[model samples]
Target: MTNNTQNGFFKLTKFEFTAIAIIMISPLLFSWSMYFQGLLIIVMLWIILGLSWNLMAGYTGQVSFGHAAFFGIGAYAAALPYFHWRISPWWGLITGPIVAVAFGYFLGKLVFKLKGPYFALGTLASGEILRIIFGEEELITNGHNGIFYMTTWTSKLPYFYIAAALAIFSILIIRKIIQSKLGFYFLSIREDQDAAEALGIDTVKYKNLSLAISAAMAGVAGAFYMIYMGFIDPEVVFALHNISIITILVGIIGGVGTIWGPAVGAIVMIFIQELFRSSLFGLGPEWLSRLHSLVFGALVVLIILYMAGGIVGDWPIIANKIKSWKNKTEGQS
Candidate 1:
């Protein structure tokens, strides 16, 4: 994620340099269909969400089940201004996360009191609570009817670059944090909170800090969603299974602790979903799109059974198996 930093210069390994170059040149590399480009844009958003979740769950060990709370809040933060006050949603880029962080701080104060699965349950409740509130608050939030705005651009090109830049920014910021002393503190808490506390690590403060940072980044993604999609609803933005669970899947599928794992996972998951939606590129029956959810469920079961640590987390085992297969073939010859 981050290489060694020189005097105010961000250094990169060869791989890092190559990855960035590829991302930068993607538009030029292919004349992609807008549908394909949109899918890629979705991948970028998921990467941002996945990385944010990883910071809390993978790194801080405070697994959250309610990140949708922040995402919805951020979207609404932008939507409300445009709906009622007539301010530009672009300002939500700044104000949205600010609002989400405030709510995150509030949520942290309540949830940080618990640990392990209880912490996750607290977050789940938080997401539900927010969903209900947003659904019922018709006067302010437009309730379940949702809010709409015209997107800033009709083409996906501008949106892709903006999302790519934000995704990179999120990754680099997290990389910087992960490389710092705060990263060590987060690791300690993930490993053992009591031991961290015994070492005077102030587990509560750092956990809250992690939640704040994580929630804020998610908020940024949500704000972008409102601007890009131009629509928001409690069911869409604050859905527990869709937003919260999918974000977790992205992290786990990609490799929870690795820097680029989510990016890889996002690409893999979306491609699979899109493939199913397109019914195996129109070879399968037309009902295939309706079965994407079932496919996702099956994928989770299969991945967990075969690779508990996830694809990136268990890459060594996979590589060894492939190597052994190649060796066996050579021996037979």
Candidate 2:
């Protein structure tokens, strides 16, 4: 609506362009240090997950609380083939998304009839059911004992590059989607479903498509996650809590409807968590580790209360204030 054609990649605003440039050059700048590179990789993975969730809950207003279901399904889908059939991870990478998309399609169909909080609760329930199934299905999921991926000598560098590439690609895909015809439909549906339907938009079809895409992207992230951790368990893979935490944090902190907001939120939240873990744990404080969640929870509450628009949303207001001050100073001078 605002002539976004002029806002292409090369034409990005200064803030956006600078961020992209930094990401593009990070591998080269940090290649000498494995610690930084590893941190970057983990951050990239979170970015992928956050972006996937943002597409569904942020843009489409579907508010799915069960993304971990797709995440776990993809991890298992990839791991099962490698463990039992001796299939290459290359194949698993492709198949994982297919499986996740199919599952997500079914889930969207079942839950789209509900709205708002009920839909969120339904998805949460669905995720919990899947987690229980994975834990109890000993023959398939190894019954919480988990499977360990054989380690390789390629080190974490390759993984870092791969994760970074995937993050960038996923962002690009989301940007495209947000700018497309379908994005308008999504926005319409999010604002008012009945009004959107009155306009002849197929709300159900678009919602399902959004869910499918979100699940597929999440599945891709999960596939890489197994490779990165080299181990998987029902608790880590299928936990409903993890899904809610990541989704809510990313969406709230990043400015939910924006394309790159989730990536920004993921980087900030993960860095904060890492800093707390490192600094607090090194002090040998018993309660610090336990208090980490409390701290994060408090931060979330404050943000929701005082900064509901999130980091990106508040940024422009801050910038405008700064600019006003600068103009007044210049006039006085």
Candidate 3:
């Protein structure tokens, strides 16, 4: 866990380098099983979303409840190109972020005027509005029937590698940004906007900047989703409960304000989701499949009650508690 910063923004750490290596080569051990590969790709997608959301909400303190706006826009940006006339969906990796940032800037102009929970609610409303609009725009979006792509590959291996690359790239970029001076400005604004303003930090400008960057990465994830999954509907991409709220929970459960928190959170959330969805590999009852959402709610409640700062944030407390219990048992023995 050693880090060396070169000129503030170009530093590398052993942990980061090791993580990349493990992610790149670990699938070989499983012999690239299609199921595991597909599952890993989904995990990478969520990692991207979690990391993107963490940038603004976790680091910059502008929590958004409507990130689905960017994700759905990205998906459509990639899909529409192919669906309308005849263009490669690959181009979406470029246009998706652009459109998302455009809308994100527009939304930022309005919502950044509000603060705290008001800002969160404003984002929630904005996401819902976009979801409705996309759902109704049959001519342009193909409505509830959704958009589908032929897909670039039959096997999940290629998609898994691509997703892993994306996840790595995004993590590096965000890490650089957070370690730079801009990262400090974001923190100052988050800690106290009025104080940051008093210090001449231009909190409004920085908040918008954070939003734009966050939106871009999220849009990229959305576009990636469209490509990987091959089909998407308004409900699937822009759903409040699934996309938006899950992102917030990822940050919260992972450990807000920490660079690695959302990553951990995304992994845990997705694993738990798959656990319930698969019904413990057919050992559990089929009815349990329907209880994933309920399990998520329960997990969140438990985390908040006992680990207010999330697993990573509260790791010391948890470790100490475990140690104390172990010592007591040893003494009794």
Candidate 4:
């Protein structure tokens, strides 16, 4: 994940740098289908969400079931300006994260007092409360009517590059954080909060910090979603299963604590999701599309049971198995 350096700060390894370079130039290197390009944007969006959830739950041990609240706030941050004042929604990119972070700070103050499932339920309720409040406030939010606008670009290329940049920025920021003293504090809190407190760490402050960062990342993704999709409703942005649950799955499937885990997870998740939704690119039976939810649920169960640490987390085990298979084939020959 990191290259050892004398100053105790980590740098990107050569392989990591090469992989990033390839990603940056991939669009230019090949003629990709428009569908593939759009899928790339979705993958980046999930990457941001995966990183967001991983920061709070994986690093800090504060599992949240309400990230949809922050995502909705971010989308509305952009949408409301356009809806109410005819202002450009682009401004929401700056304001969205700020608003989400403020909300996170307040929420953390209330929920951090509770621990374990109590905390999870508290956070979960926050998203549901927001959904109801937004849905009822037709005067301000237009209720279930939602907001709609035209996207700025006709081509997907611009959006693809923007999403890719955001994904890269998120990866670098997370990498830096995890390599710093702040990351150590987060790990300590996760391992044992009481012990961290006894060691003079400000557990509350660090936890809040983690939540704020997580919220900001999720908010940015929401802002981008609104800008790209050019439409939003309380249901679409705040859906517990779609936005919040998918974000959690992205993190858990990618390898919760590793740096590149979410990146890989996002890629796998988006492809599987799109493949199923498209019903094998329209070649499969219509029933396949309807079975996406069932298929995804089964996949998640299998991953959890067989690869508890996730793909990246359990890579060594996987590698050994592959090697064993190769050796057995050689012996048979």
* Per-model TM-score versus the true fold: 0.95, 0.90, 0.94, 0.95
Q: All predictions: root-mean-square deviation over Cα?
A: 2.0, 3.0, 2.0, 1.9
Q: Which portions of model 1 show Cα errors greater than 4 Å?
A: 1-9, 29-32
Instruction: Give the per-residue lDDT of model 2 (tens digit) for 1-333.
Output: 235643554356566567777887887787787777778888898888888888888889888788888888888878888777777654656877888898898888789989999999988888889889888988877878987887454577778777888888888788778877888888888888999999999999999999989999888888888878778887888887776567668778877888777887888777667667665637756555566556667777888887787777677776798999999999999
lDDT tens readout by residue for model 3, 30-133: 56477777777888888888888989988889989999999999999999989998787788899999999999999999999998899999999999999999
Superposed model 2: Cα runs more than 4 Å off: 1-3, 6-17, 31-33, 280-290, 321-333
Candidate 3: list runs displaced more than 4 Å: 1-11
For candidate 2, what is the lDDT? 0.80
In candidate 2, residue 124 scores what lDDT? 86
lDDT of each: 0.88, 0.80, 0.87, 0.86
**Candidate 1 TM-score, true structure as reference:** 0.95
- Top-down lDDT ranking: 1, 3, 4, 2
